[model samples]
Target: MPSQQDDADPVDTSVAHPARRYDYLLGGKDNFEADRESARLIAERMPTIRLVAQENRWFLHRVVRFLAERGIRQFLDIGTGIPTSPNTHQIAQDVDPTARIVYVDNDPLVLAHARALLTGDPLGDTAYLQADLREPRKILDDPQLRQVLDFSEPVGLLLIAVLHFIRDDDDPKQIVDTLVSALPEGSFVAATHVTLEYMSPEQFAAVRARAEHQSAVRSGAELTALFEHPRLQVVEPGAQSVSRWWPDEAPQPRPSIEDVACNGILARVGPRSA
Candidate 1:
């Protein structure tokens, strides 16, 4: 892994960043009062938002494990927040000790603490890149990503809980298409996006008011559009609530779509037409 100190970016603690706020919501301590306060404000509007984060994480774990089970040994996780247990590398390495992972994020704080995310099994390798998802070409061309991942082989691309941060003006679909296009056949894209489909009008309004600056909340159809590129084919279960996507086991009390408030999908890159 490259050293973050060589190109150390300044971190602004005065503002509430989405990654830090998400860390706070996940009960992690690598966040500031600004993040905690922002999380508190959002919680006031959506009481179950914390659970939503947890379920979103659960979805991530399941997808990583599923990919490993399908013989995928390389991973590129974008929008990776603060270091959390059972991270993409951890989960993938658990299945195969030789799995390699590349973690990408724009948060300077996440880069500052990236050393923690590098401690993977001896057989596997882990690396971090301080980059934004909007610049898919740069991320695809990054030296570290090329060093750790072989574009000729199938790689699991994780976009969990990050797409919402990309507004429509950025052309999120094209961004996704660009990333997927760079990967070889059989590579998979697993993503989860915040949705307003399950929320009532009043609840949606409250959430939008709190998160408008943070991200754009889309409906289910809009969220699905991000994965509808010609080169991609939807996997089983298609796009559905994060909690409902291939759960390890059905919850004793099953969570409704409203409880998760997010949609997730795992799709594969298809062969190009002759």
Candidate 2:
């Protein structure tokens, strides 16, 4: 919450941004006609789009709370879409009042709504930066970010619903490796992405076709390789449907391919290698 002045441009209003479309799904008013149109079209084909969004948000909340309870103090959340109730800082700071978090997103609206994300306990610090994930180094080296996060110590790296925006040629795995390599060994990584794991070849083909016309969706193996630290171990119920990971109560597993298109997981960076 550094800049109070109208120092930056609002997020683009012309083309539909995935973040805005997601906001529409979450029923926020910050979205535009283009965003709503895209969301509506996709939802027409998939009626449960809003449910998926809610489930993903719940997954984020649960993971942040779990990590905070385990004593993590610093977090770097990339692709943090428009802020909603119980955002990352909310969950973490609730557990540890002194927790520090840095939220990064390319969407200008995300920066426009920085005030919401910066609301942290007086003891803890929260910062929102307008940056792209392709430039992870500049973000890590940012002065405000440096003020709040200590790279030499453990930090939670979150990449939820964002990696699909990056294509295979972007070397998403390398990006993760570079970021993870910079963190101390005890750090952790939490990630989620749209996948077509539970669909038939034809069914998956149809799903993929739909997503191709709209968003980026990856396969399970491709997502798993994104976190390839020899030392890191995935938490229980690893990379299953988001509903299955540490659910407060068991969710009836989705019985059909259309029921699940997103997968979520949490992995602890191995304690500093001996």
Candidate 3:
């Protein structure tokens, strides 16, 4: 696993954290009451919080497998929440035993679990880094990441469901540019973000205020701008609802069109393949 501080600050349970809140939404057991409450309130307004999360994870899995199948062996997964089953390392390594992964997250609770449970394939490697999304350079510069990955080769840069926590003031586009610029062309960028376009303006406002009161989330246009750069080429279904992004096994579409709340995409970081 990636290294940790000898005396890192203990987890702060008094306030709800984005990672723990997400874990709560995903029905994971690693969250506190505060996190659950926040998730519940969000669900009260948007009943499909759990379903949206699952859909995003499904997209992550399919994107990883798709990228791994294309011969990319290095992965940089940011905002890696609690060590959910079939993690990025597990998925990538399954396709190629030598696939290397570096998981990054700023949450102390997620870090604690990651430090205790990250396991890599015998032929490959996996490491966890505790770092904030705002500090893309820190993650892109981590020695552990450098040791396991070569920027000169193609790599997968993932920011699933984490960018929403970054407000417009944070200049998410700049952060993304910094990370993607560090990798070679042929690399891929897969991201999932929360949005409000699915709801009526009134419903959107209600939930928007709710998310802002607890956690910072963004709009669809804002998320699209995160991928703004001439070097990247969005894949076929660019930035669609997570449920509609290349669904394999063709999950039965929800009975209603109003079943999703998250937007995501899997784009490549190179000239379009002819």
Report the C-alpha lDDT of model 1 over 45-143, residue by residue, as the tens digit.
888889899888888988998899999999999999998897998889999999999999899889877875568988888999889999999999988
Per-residue error for 95 in candidate 1, Å, reads 0.7
Give candidate 3 misplaced runs (Cα > 4 Å). Answer: 214-217, 254-257, 271-274
* TM-scores for every candidate against the unseen true structure: 0.95, 0.90, 0.93
lDDT agreement of model 3 with the native? 0.82
What is the Å distance of residue 24 in model 3 from its true position? 1.9
Better of 1 and 2 by lDDT: 1
Worst ten-residue run, lDDT, model 1? Answer: 2-11
Whole-model lDDT values for every prediction: 0.87, 0.79, 0.82
Candidate order (lDDT): 1, 3, 2
Poorest 10 consecutive residues by lDDT, candidate 2: 249-258
Which candidate tops TM-score?
1
- Pairs that clash in candidate 3: 2-128
